[model samples]
Target chain A: MSQVNWRTINVDALDPDSALNFDMSTLTPAVTPVSASEVQGLAGQIRQLLRGGDHEGALRGALESVPYGADEKGKEIHLHTVIEILQSIRQSEMSPLLSRIYQSEGGSELLDVLMKYLYKGMSHTTPTGGAKQMAPQATGFSQIHPLRTGDGGGQAMSVFLSWHEKLVEIAGPGSIVRVMCDRRTV
Target chain B: MAQPEIHHLFHRPIADHSFSSDRQTLAVARDNLIEIYGKSGQKFALQDELRGHDKTVTGVDIAPNSGRIVTCSQDRNAYVWEPSSSGWKPTLVLLRINRAATCVRWCPSESKFAVGSGARVIAVCYFEEENDWWVSKHLKKPIRSTITSVAWHPNSVLLAAGSTDGHARVFSSFIKGVDERPAPSVWGERLPFNTVCGEYLNSTAGWVHGCEFSPSGDALAFVSHDSSITVVYPTGPDMEPKAVLSVATQLLPFMGLIWTSENEIIAAGYDCAAYRLRGDEQGWQLAGSVESAGRPGMDSHREESALNMFKQMDLKGKVQDDTKLKTVHQNTITTIRSYAGSPERVRQFSTSGVDGRVVIWSV
Candidate 1:
């Protein structure tokens, strides 16, 4: 019961006889998804810094703004704030945020730094069985980041799903299986 | 409240968990068997395993006073386990349902048990003294979908069932011979078997995951897939409820909920945390999460070697923080049962989850 992604389920796939026939549309109304403009406004400075080719500067702001060391409640609000920014910005605008963080000096490190907030933030918001594990095959960074063409990050969950997908995609094809095999011995 | 006791028993998801009346014994339904654990000084050690069902055991309940364990499974069967001098004796129950049995609960009187099934029916089983066997009487009426949960009212005759059909309905399981005449209440006056006392569909028509009766059994609280908890206070049978307070939240939907008092409810699900909901016949609202402290490892900046950092970077293209959740239960909490207190004034409750953890927390 906890294994499948209930949200990702296509509504038409529901079997009348099965227990999974939960109408997911009930979720859509509560999702006051951070509006695109609000997201743009929240991430305005970071957007400007990235567009101006100051990748390092944008990465710094992304990393510095997070209250990683804050207490539980403070961290939750801050994470939501960061998530709001991520969820708000359009993929056209957000893709650059990812690309810049990856392209800059120690950009990979910055991506990792940024990912910490994303990961921790998601854990905070999602309910127990509600959290979904993105398929391992989809865990490729290149396919995930979409570099220029952003397709999957349209929904709220895509933000978390895109993380590992981009990770494996960046490593190219066999790296996931290879690296896992290497880690097994180490 | 002292710290919660964490028992990481195994890797398998715990379908359901129950503590003995004395709190010295624990029963957990795993894949196909119900594992019984004896609580030692502070931890539960595996004492015995009851194996009878061929398929996954979906639900298990321990009758407080009878010391009998009732378990139902995907194999379309239910078993009553009685502790004997040797170990435990298993008595087969004739559910007669074709599809998988989803959940089961013993009535407060412990004389009867109800098994909800995918066959679109609830099998109310009781011991037929003449036959000397557990026999079931089907409550098949307006149920449209698989039953996910069933909560027995304090009176034992009123049963609340939440189903995938997005409805939580109240029914009369009154057996003429077995059950005593229940006093007239807001639920109904004339009660008969399979009587639909009240029927409620989720406001958003989402699948109802959990349904529970208040301590007084006058109110019902259910959590649905819409990430909302609704409290229903009945006015009278076959009439509009006095209040149907639906408290919606932004978190993911809850898997199960329990009423601690007439005005207090605690629900836990996919969010992996239990949240408190408080209200009355007037209005109800989400109080907040029961646990506030975030996941561990997120708080501390542990120093690691440069080599370690490089290895993480080399392997995953980032320094991943793959640590367990900060909450007591690291995964989805499937069921939260009252542990240390009575229904009205519960002092502590226990939650078992997909992570195979049984955590007892103070209320």
Candidate 2:
């Protein structure tokens, strides 16, 4: 007889008025809505830190003030800044920097937030609204961020995947489970 | 410390097991049937098999005072087996849920039992005297996913349920006729059926696998898929809990946990070894592995001949024996129950794992 994975079975497919159809919005904790200007201001500071080769500061700045309550445009701006910092760090410095971050207070939680952003960065495709809303272009910042394009996105994916690998290596799979189950969306 | 008693029952996984008050009879959920074993000497002999459910049995609990065995299965059915001269008579319970039952636990009073189901409902069943059949009342509200485990409070009125939705909720399963009025407590003043007393979510929101009320029934502790166990102490009704201490472990997520006392908890899961966690509402931390590093029954004084050492180095390229794990259990431990002593202070506990072995360890 073929073995069945009972726990993963979708019982709701059989019952129409199933209790599983819960309102997901209520499950997540409500957050104070962040304005677009706040997200843009943070992004500007993180970019300046990145330009000065303070990758650690840039990473911390990007992760600490997550735009969990930000609007779509604000979140997109923050995501671009986060992905840029994630890619700018040298491969050799990755482990050392992660160790420092992990040892800090609330280190594990910070890593969890990073893991969530990594997941979002990987699946994030081109947004529905076009680049018409693009803020005043920063001079040195890349015109086309890899994750926002229909093509040449594999580079961005590999970067996020590698960071994910290093993260799980240090923080263990608990971080992944935390990011996956946490309802405090970012 | 005494060596843990290891019993290799069978190759099949034992999802749940329960021992009688006398510790003479043991019932284990083996595949689709419930196997009852009678202890004769040190080993248990197969005495009987209660075969009814067509699906895998998820849980089984024997009421301490009554010696009645309650079993729930993934087939969406529950049966109460009563001891009789003819044999064990099985009475089917009307759960009235569309999904499979995940867990069941007999209340301390043994008057009623709660069955948690994938239907996202807990069916608190009690015997209706007029009909002479077991019937249930559904607690349906706020639960968002499959119920993973259910535990009865010492008062038998408050029920704690852990679910895949990352919430461990406490509810009042107070059946009007079957239960007497419970005294006012921190949970609430007037208890009514389906009253949600407490709902807790860990910081990580991992799927809660096991939950239990503290020995005094004043606090709740739950193990979640994030490899953390959180202990919640309620301050009062409609008030913030005094404290919720979450101790995160680097090990694999715990599948089951049992509080040995007010301050100590023994938890085991995919890590294959039970770990002791020590703390209280003030603070909590993972103490260490319950079992020592040395694997039991190994011949520590085995003489290693010169030729044997060379052979070992040649064949495996290393003389050290690294094949077996330091822990006794070789696979994930699915269930851990207090084997001896009261729930207030357990002296010994028994754990059954997917490795097909049940080991009783002293605390």
Candidate 3:
């Protein structure tokens, strides 16, 4: 028999005085607002914990303070932040955290969401042909590199990720992540 | 994975099967007898028994152009037999070798055939003066070790020989003049890393058991005692190691290696597993694994062993007892030959050990 455990978000664990705080406004359909000063404070605290090599503690704090199973947009932002923090974890010993995420209920769905957002962010923005003559440009964000074209480099990177995802799918979330992390350390 | 379906074509134990160039008829060697069978499994009855070799025949080959058959045996004589209305009879017997003739291979054009013996020398014989075949030239420079396997390139006039000395050498046709049979000249050599068990050098110089040339004639594949298959190519300008596929854990002391196609190589070892290594794959894959059909009287012997040691109080009981050994059909697969005419035919050819059983596998 197989078992699954869904991890719960503990947003109350965040210290009120920390330098980095989770901004409530960036979350779509904002319900509450946290001052920029508070987010800066929380970020500082995270940096200090990382420098002190308290990786596990820092990761736990970040995961606990994130809102999960919220509105779709808000959930997306929260999950994105969690992915960024997990990626930043330096020590290979932090594999247990990844394993816990993989084994959690709805783990596959969460990973799917993460992959969709990552792929969308890497896609190129095309030029608009005739969109109401752009009555009033909201914010101009020009394409960065004109020479960056074609799918060769991006497709190669995607192929590698696809292979990794397929392995994870075959191994299941929990044990596969733990094994991969352990192998990385070795 | 599902196991392959095994069909029994012939119940009588056969030693080996050499298909005619057209693959319409099969030349089978069983014990001291040789029989030809048609494609329909009907005994051609063309020959009851070819009376030439005294000992059990070890290997057999059929000329590509002519339908002449060659059989080698522990009798230390390689006989060339021609089919006639009455029966198959020996046309010529090359009797100059000291050790048992292990393998015989006829060139593609059927003009010449090479025979290897335990004597470490490869003798090339040619069919000269109608109906008579004689040794045109021979390499007496005995390979530093016993020559266990020999194969001719598909099209080119070249021969590849593998020896127990952990090396496979390629030789070019040295036939000087049409009248003056010439000796073969050494072209190149390929040496693979020693076996992992560290017995590469000390192991008997007869470890090289199998050798074959790819259909393209650009590469040669061979196996050693270490259970590793090495592929060597001499056409590349730089002579780089083209490909090396290891069956280290699957195949041990492979006795037969043959190319099923340009990209697939099939090899069978002492173990019952038949392995296939794809051209693009990094390692050999298990194509077929077969356990012995059954062992007769094996259960009773084990029970007796325990009784003899405990209740019987027989202190003189031999620990390595050979008398109670089970007579199972686990003969080492000696040779594997693909169908020459139908490349994708269902039945592939193979030969075995003491029983001299010839098996046709449906692929």
Candidate 4:
């Protein structure tokens, strides 16, 4: 050809800025990846604590072993254990339990972990188990009834929202922002 | 506390600023041009402007000793300005990257400078005597995202970089000819080029916005987008750190931070105020805001009557003047540099912000 038509060529198409071109695996810190089995082991211990009526111990246990590097299944298991611990606490004991945890050593960090789980639990749309069934009702009505149970999703959402409200009262709005901006999966 | 010395520059963001070693010349990256201000009497007057880049100037630094002004911009280029009898002359550096350069810093030795870019690379550039111009050696491995900021170790061989990938890394930028063999330290001994000395990720995986080595170079501290500052103290080479303290704050995320002393850090960002964090290896906490609690414009003593409303509306074209923030900066402070005193004990520091003001604060 005498001359190539440069104007006809698309620049972006020729040099695409595709995400696949960049390898992000090496960018993370060299923390040992928390395996799924390790998460299971921690869940078992948390369950034992929960069965013994040690809700605080179970919550602490769950919060302490947050699998930040583990897969989705591990995170889901930890979230379930944490929800169980939160649900067992009496409504009147919520503030007292929070204050107690907040005062303990490394308590703020534990609360931060719990805040992460609360956010995870709230964003979870697909229900896990069939312990409680929720009717398809208006969003406003569902929020009005925190204890009312129907389906797993709605009740879990209400629980998460209730804890979030109380969490803000104690931890302030910064906790939510931290959880949102934090990129660690768990 | 003495009142902060404030210079209201033109109404534009100062992305980066540097003061000459003698504290007479001030170079600030104002939008697309580098505006040079000379200290005269008590105030800084506009002296000259260096214009070369076609895009926003992202970073600027004047070598403390050499007085060479190095500037990088979004146009994917960097310039080293040298002062001659005629004026300042610019020499374009060969930063063969395809993306915008975000930040730059002159090494303590003033022999080499590091330019962090959006292309996931840090170009450590130095002058090549053979070529008689500046050339760059790219640190391309292990960086996955835009490099937000870079800091040079006191030794001038080890470089600390903060990136959007949420990891703050220490790399040995030991150019064989440009840098001498640094003495053995906690970081490492045999530091060839591109040696990964240390990498610390933000606990919450927030994008690292700022990174700085301690005055002693034994510790590294970085501020992330999660509104937390994490300090890393390495024990030895190829070993776990002695302590990695992450201090979460309730205020907004800090865009820049500087180690005032070994145990103290001053950080400022979207909160429009400088906060002092104090602690040692024991623990770190948000000590307090550097700005005193109650200032003149902090109180909202507006008369809620129609007369006052009409007066305010007539004077300012608004019913209420809620625009002024209680803080001195009134906008996000982007960069905080050690202005005076040694790194061991910074007696004074300067902060530049989007509000087009450079404030010199005494510690």
User: Candidate 3: lDDT of B324?
Assistant: 33
Q: Which stretches of candidate 3 lie over 4 Å from their true place?
A: A1-186, B1-15, B22-24, B38-47, B130-132, B177-206, B235-247, B281-330, B340-356
Consecutive 10-residue window with the lowest summed lDDT within model 3 chain B: B194-203
Residues B1-363, model 3: lDDT tens digits: 222322233445455668787766767777666666665453333434577778877678887677889888888888888877777768656648777877788877677778877766777777666655666455544255567777876543577777755556666544534322322222233211111101112111224678887766666677766455666544333344444443332234566777776667777756544556666334445454433333244466556656565654556555444543242334566666775334333245443443444444433
Off by over 4 Å in 2: A1-17, A35-37, A71-73, A90-93, A118-166, B292-325
| Candidate 1 chain B: worst-modelled 10 consecutive residues by lDDT | B293-302
CA lDDT, every prediction? 0.75, 0.86, 0.52, 0.85
Error of 3 at A134 (Å): 92
Two-chain complex of model 2, DockQ on C-alpha atoms against the true structure? 0.32
Chain B vs. true chain B: TM-score per candidate: 0.94, 0.95, 0.70, 0.95
Each model's TM-score? Answer: 0.67, 0.85, 0.50, 0.83
Whole-model lDDT, model 4: 0.85
**Backbone clashes, each candidate:** 20, 0, 16, 4
Residues B89-155, candidate 4: write the lDDT tens digits. 9999999999999999999999999999999899999999999999999997778789999998999
CA RMSD of each candidate after superposition: 14.1, 7.1, 25.7, 5.7
**Displacement of the residue B57 alpha carbon in candidate 4, Å:** 1.1
lDDT of 2: 0.86
For model 2, residues B1-363, the per-residue Cα lDDT tens digits are: 788888888999998999999989989999899999999999988999999999999999999999999999999999999999999999999999989999999999999999999988999999999999999999988788899999999999999999987899999999887899998888998889989999998876778999999999899999998888999999989999999888766678899999999999999998899999999889988888888645455555245788988888999998867766657787899999999998888999999989888888998
Clashing pairs in 2: none
Q: Name the better of 2 and 4 by lDDT.
A: 2
